[model samples]
Target: MDVISAVGAAIRTAFDMFWDVLWPLVLGFGLSGIVQALVSHKTMAKLLGDDSPRSLSLATLFGVASSSCSYAAVALARSIFRKGASFVSAMVFEIASTNLVIELGVILIVLLGWQFAASEFLGGIVMVILLALIFRVTLTPRLVSLAREHAERDAVGRMEGHATMDMSVQGGSFLSRLLSGRGFTSISHLFVMDWASVWVDVAGGFLIAGALAAWVPESFWQHLFLSGNPTLAKIEGPLVGPLVAIISFVCSVGNVPLAAVLWRGGISFGGVVSFIFADLIVLPVLDIYRRYYGGRVMLYIFATFYVTMAAAGYIVEIVFGALGIIPSNRAVGIITHGPSWNYTSILNIVALVVAAILLVRFLRTGGPAMLRMMSKPETSGEHDHQAIAMDRSIP
Candidate 1:
């Protein structure tokens, strides 16, 4: 291909990937916003106050209803930890928030397939359990104390207010509030905040997938993944999956598209799962974790997360093999011709309209000001943990 054609191909590939998953993103985040509006953060903190099975389970459930942005999850996890939630429970919440989120799963289904999405849910639970175990064994009181001190220092996570705000509509029944004006405002804030939190990751995933698909020779990925030997591929894929994510500059729901590209490139099924599970461990996120919880806690979080993610991947490989569902076809190709007239295109058009409506609602609700504060640490995080109004439902 000529230089112009090559560039055009890359751009088209990226757009195609974006168009394919655009509707799913809208649907997932919109629903997540609704969930958040119904749930209260104070309730979350109260229920997750201890590290018992009950607390951990509630934390996971709360996280599934909360924001799916990895940064926001980290920020929120810190918020609860500072509020007396156990360190292990908070860590479990962080994992569930990012991995078991609706948008992440929807995007996975759209891009890769149902099987990959299934693996995500299954592996996510396994990863969380392993993470909890690791933290219980290695996380000591002194380390927790140091981490608490660092959180009190308020080093300013990127989406502090986005994570900290409790905009759930007050008064009225569930349906009434969901249909109220304040409810719309809450949803808009959540929807916009969710987008702002992960736009970079999503766009980065698209661009990286495009570049990788257009430039990297299949032989390189195949040889690197040990695709010629099935057994070696299974072992190496899980091991290298997180390394790919660490360097990919993409995480959260954003990683799904690139995961698609990697799946097509010759990675094993378990390798794909491991890659998606590593979003929070990416370099930028690791820095964010360091800021939120201090270096010692960050190191433990990294070590535990990486080991659990890899183990989950291997377990998925064995389980899927037993179930006779491991896919042999890895020949899916990226779209380079722009969006064709199809159901996905129609859905994209409809989704764009929904997104536009939400954006308008957000701006009118002082979302721009909220965003300004959220983006800058000086403004939004001046006192990140300076206790919000103590209001919660003790479930």
Candidate 2:
């Protein structure tokens, strides 16, 4: 009976997460697709020029306007990095796309309340600034050379094509087209691509949340990292939560529900925030980074991001506490009853259909095929041996 009840509860939680996040994700994805269509790669390259002080800001805006998938972000960052974006700026883009996007902000506002939502944006900016400052102080020529060599190898010694808007005008002036450039077909395609990008994360997060709701023993979490002090307890959450996130292998916004579960399980506020922030350091991305930059570069990236997240999480907890905004309980239940035939269920079905149509459109359009053509194995130059050495060292 207890087991059956748990299973039922999990299903309800998953359904509720799906219901709350699906529409906002669709809107976010569309906005990203339109932005991608409009922004030229040359423009991005110029904005991210080595000497541009505004490079980080431009990177942040581009990231918020681009796709939210961590894997996709990695590919896009690599593409821009090849075109002269600084490593720091590219990292900032990755962070922004993951944390500061429209869908994420909307979901946070809806699920966790406006304060947590605001903290996410504030925390993202802080993370970006820290990354830029870290780069200024710790960047080594060897690291830069390695990244460039790997990027060139990945491109097979050629630059990848930029994402450009496909506007067909019948001999009209630039301004004439700019004001009314898109037809019905273009608008539909934009919505389709946007929905597809966000749908995967939403569904994945639901599935994971369901599993956690059903199977994770609640008692185990209450004692994992008790140090008898709130600040110390909070500080420790970031460290352990990220380790768990890395091992879980679900990147992007898919990690949110799990973070919520941790918050419910007595993990500190800073810890939950850190777990959410540490998505970039997860296994799939780390493996790709290793493939792209060899072990040394990967290690540096891991250390840099991990330390920065720890600090950010602690700072957020302190700020929120001082401001008297820290919630007494992080897990305010969203779904009280089991799934049934209702408005939310109807909407869930609709979201599923919408997701499927968008997915089909995305594959049929140029995006998926283009990404496939672009994903080539990079050679690790001098770091090839270092990669091997590092793997052995990872006990």
Candidate 3:
């Protein structure tokens, strides 16, 4: 009974954290959907043709306007690669798509704090610049040829349909089109599809965070992070953070809540930053890279990406510290007891109603069929063709 009781408590804590951030997530994703729906993927491909500053900036803009689904980002990055975007350029876009998006910023603010959110943005920029520079220096012509060949041969990854869908409303000004029924339809599809891509990560994140928060002793984290010694902790935090993230297997916005847990438990500010950045390189994602871009290219990406993330975290920590902006108090802001009937409940009710309506629309509009086809391996060429046809037919 005690064990069951403890388990129940952990889940309850997890749900409370989810409840707190539920409304912000809905709002963020809703806005992300609208932005994604408005932009054409073809335009993005054109602007991302090279790894020059202009191209990298354009890539960042496109990434901010994209869905916050990491899988979708990977799929879209492959699409970028296939469209003749430089290899370094494609990676920069992938990094921005997952890390620099508006929804991620909003969720980070809500779960952690504004300072943390700011660090994420700053660190994200650092990561992108470093990724581009390092890849250019180290990437070989053979690796590029191999990756391009692999992309040409097999273009699909997780959330292929989600990345491929171009539901942007045509004609009229942006506002006018956004108010149209077709606009609403596009937003609904984007919302549901984006949610579908990352819901598992979100759920798993909350559960893992809750269990860790309830069961792990404070001393353990402090010891692991070397919190007793500030110098060592700062140095080691960025180094170890990614390892933890890789093993956690919870990436994307879902891991932010867990990051909050880590921060409160004595992780360095840099540690939190690197851990969040490491989501893209989680074990699952590394394997995805391997399959999508071939073994040698995947290894190259792994080394460069890991080094960049760690370096960015370390840099952010130093800058923020020198500026005296690092929050002195790191508190885990989860609800102690279960959530009460308050603003959260009210917002959740509204958000769920919206989600339900969108889900209904998704089902009625052939989303399930597309999802099934996209969920299959790259070998499913026939299904891919069918899914593409079906997507084209959608209004």
Candidate 4:
């Protein structure tokens, strides 16, 4: 009976956290869908063909405008790489898509604070710059060749279909295309597809966070984070942050809830930031990298990513500490709150209505079939053409 009660409490906490962020998630995804519906992957590929400053900048911008699903981001990065994007640029895009997205920032603001959200974006840029330098120095022509050769093979990874599907509406002014039937269908399709790609991770993150918040003693977290010694904690937080995240098996925006738990449990601000950035290096994503780029390149990526993620955490911690903006109060309300008549509830209601509308559009316009193909690997541009044809047929 005690265990059952505990489980229920954990689930309730998870639901509360989900409820708190529901509106931000919906708004972020809606905006992302609109961007995806307008931007062509072909244009992104063309712009990112080289590793110049321009290409890398464009990659970051494009990544911020894309889906925040870690799996989809990884798959799409590979697709762009195979389609003529420079290796460094592709990696930057992957990092930006997962770490610097709008949904992620909004969720952080809601759960942790605006400081955390700011740290995430700032640290993301630092990580990207660090990674680009590292790659420029260490990425060899032979390694690139090996990765390309492996990627060219018919190996499968999660969200391959999503990465390849291009539903961008074309052949009109921006406003005209956006107001067209094809535009609505395109946005709905991309929105649903993005949700499908990351729902499991998101759910898992909330559950784990809730469980940790409910069952784990504050003493345990304090000891694990070395909270007794401020100096040591600062040094260790950034270093160990990514290691914890690598084992968490949670990625994308899903990790934000867990991050809030960690912060409340006495983790340093830098630790929370680094943990969020390390989503790309989670065990499952590491395996995907191994499958997509062979073991050698995978190992190389893991090494570079770890160093940069940790470094970025350390830098952000120092910079933010100097600015005196790190929120001293670590209390997150969602962990203890239940359903109530409040602003959160009001926003969640509105969000659900928006979600329902998009979902209805998705169901009415052949979204189920598209979802079935989300995991299937793409072999050519045939899928994009077919998707565009289907969009034209809508309405």
Candidate 5:
């Protein structure tokens, strides 16, 4: 009975955390879908063909406009890279897509507070810049060629269909494209697709977080995070944060809930930020990288990502600490409070209605067929043809 009760408690905790962020997730994904509907993948590929500062900037912008699912983002990065985007630009895009997207920022603000949101966005840019510099110095012509060769071989990775699908409404003003029947269909499809891609990671993250919160003792976390030594904790936090994330096997915005658990358990502010940023380097992703870019490139990516993630954490920790914006109180409400009548609840209700409407539109518009293709390996032409057919069916 005790064991069952413990399991129930953990599940309940996870559900509460999900409820708290439901509205923000809906709002973020909805906005992301709208942006994906408006922006052409081909255009993004054309703009990111080189690793110039201009190209990198455009990659960041386009990435922010893309899906927040880490797997989708990684898959799309490979797709763009294969389509002529520079390796550096492609990686930067992947980072921004997962870390700097609307959904991630909104969820961070809702759960961890504005400081974390600010740190994530600001640190994300810092990490990107750091990664770009590292790649410039370390990435060689031969390495790039090798990676491209492997990518062109089209080794199947998670979300291959999603990566190749180009559902953007073409040839119209932004508002016209957004409000058009095709635009609505495009948005609904992308929204549902994005949700389908990362729901597992999100659910897993919540359950792991809930279990950790319910089953683990506070002292254990404090010891693991080195809470007893202030100076050392700050230094160690950034160093160890990514390692924790790597093992957790959670990626995308899903890791945010676990981050909250860590924060309350006495991880330094920077540690939490680094943990969030380290989703790309999770174990499963590393294996995907190996398949996509070969073993050597995978190791290179993992090394570079880890160093930059930790550096970004350290930088944010110092800057935010100096500015006194790092939240001292770790008692975040989402971790402690169950579902209650509040603004969060009200927003969740409205958000669910909006989501239901979109889901209905998605189901009516052949979304299941598209979803079935989400993990399949396909040629770019096939993806394009299917996208066009789906759009035509809507009208």
Candidate 6:
């Protein structure tokens, strides 16, 4: 194709990809908002306290049920961190939201392969544990103090997002809601929060993916990543793939396609997993960290995460290889269709529009006023274990 036609085609392709995820992003974000309402800062604070294994496990479980949006995950991480969660627990929440969600996992299997999905799942658990271990050893008292100072600063200067309406649950047994008895209004509140959290991440991811499709050459991907030299190939592949993914700024399941391309071009198994793990370190997420935490804390956390992800990837690759379960060879193309007009895309566009409207409204209303609009349930106790007030609007 001629240069002009090629560029034109690329633009259309980008648009098509964005179109495809637009609705899912919206629906996902709304659902995120809803879940946020159901989960109070008190509940989250209790479930993500310092030095408690129970807290960590609950945080992970909460994240899995939360939205699959990277932005939302970052937001939530920042919020919980500010609300007095230990750095490790906060990071666990971030990992679980990005990697352990149901929809994202299914999407990875559909677009990449079952193997990729499995790696992502197991790798995420390993990553959280590695991070916890790192923090336990390397995170000094100074670092903890520094994080707290930053968290306080962030709590004060935090920018407003769409705050979920406070959902009021009936004072009843758990079996009631689990069986057949949630109020309709409470359910709606849950839906709204869910949408708010996941959409922005999806939108940001799609925008980045589109830009890449429009400008980056497929061949360029092959050379930097793909290689057959075992030593140079092994570390280089994992390292470079994640580096590129970080700069590319896509995260969560949205990263699967680009990862698949890198793998197909001959990047190693470790490389693919590293790329997946690098989701939280992307530019936007880092920016969120800087905003929520201070520059020093952000730097420390970033360095820690980068090392932990790379190590986890290498370890998993070695273990899997030794076990003779390294998937024989790399999986091939799974993103069968390119950008096109479809029901999914149409839904995404509609969702985006709705999200935009809510964002505008939230901005105009301002954070405190918006929070006031969300009434709390009468006689609710203080958030568990928090030394400070926190915004639940975070991821």
What lDDT would each prediction earn against the true structure? 0.83, 0.65, 0.82, 0.88, 0.90, 0.61
| C-alpha RMSD between model 5 and the true structure | 1.4
Clashes of each: 0, 2, 0, 0, 0, 26
Candidate 4: where are CA atoms >4 Å away?
A: 385-395
Residues 1-395 of candidate 5: C-alpha lDDT, one tens digit per residue: 39999999899999999999999999999999998888878788889999999999999999898988888888999988987889999999999998999999999999889999999999999999999999999999998988998888878779888877888878779888888778888888999999999999999999999999999999999999999998999999999999999999999999999999999999999999899999999999999999999998999999999999999999999999999888989997877778899888999999999999999888887878888888887564447623544555566
Compose the digit string of candidate 6's lDDT tens values, residues 1-395.
Answer: 67897667655655555444445545554555445434544467656778577877887887876656576566656666666677788888878887777656555554456776777788878888888887888888887787777666634221223221234343565445323223333333344444444445555555555445556675666566646466777778667766877887676666765665566566778888888888888887787677667788788878888887787778778877777776654534212256455666566577677766655434432333434422332113222211111122222
Span of 10 residues, lowest total lDDT, candidate 3:
381-390
Best by lDDT: 5
List per-candidate RMSD values in Å.
Answer: 3.9, 9.2, 2.8, 1.5, 1.4, 6.9
Encode model 4's per-residue lDDT on 1-395: one tens digit a residue. Answer: 39999999889899989888988889888888998888888788899999999999999998988889888889999998988998899999999999888889889998888999999999999998999999999999999999999988867888888887888888889999888888888888888888888899999999999999989988998999999998888889988889999999999999999999999888888899899999999999999999999999999999999999889999999999999998888789878665678888898899889889889888887788888778888774436633544554457
Evaluate model 4: give its lDDT: 0.88
Among these predictions, the greatest TM-score belongs to 5
lDDT of 3 by residue, 145-219 (tens): 999988887745677766666667667999987876666667777787778889999999999999988888889
Estimate the overall C-alpha local distance difference test score of candidate 6. 0.61
Q: After superposition, how far is residue 26 of candidate 2 from its true place, in Å?
A: 2.1
- Predicted structure 1, TM vs. truth: 0.93
Better of 5 and 6 by TM-score: 5
TM-score pick, better of 1 and 3 = 1
In the range 1-395, model 2's lDDT, one tens digit per residue, is 48788778777778776666565566555555555545444467668866245888889998887666676677667767877888777778888878887767766665667776777887888888887888888989889889878766663221112122221222355444334423222333445544444456557767777777667766677677553567668768878877878887777777876666677777887787888888798886887788667778889999999988877777888899899998886564664434456664666577678666655544444434333333233332211211222122211
Question: Candidate 3 vs candidate 4: which has greater TM-score?
Answer: 4
The full ranking of all candidates by TM-score, starting with the best, is 5, 4, 1, 3, 2, 6
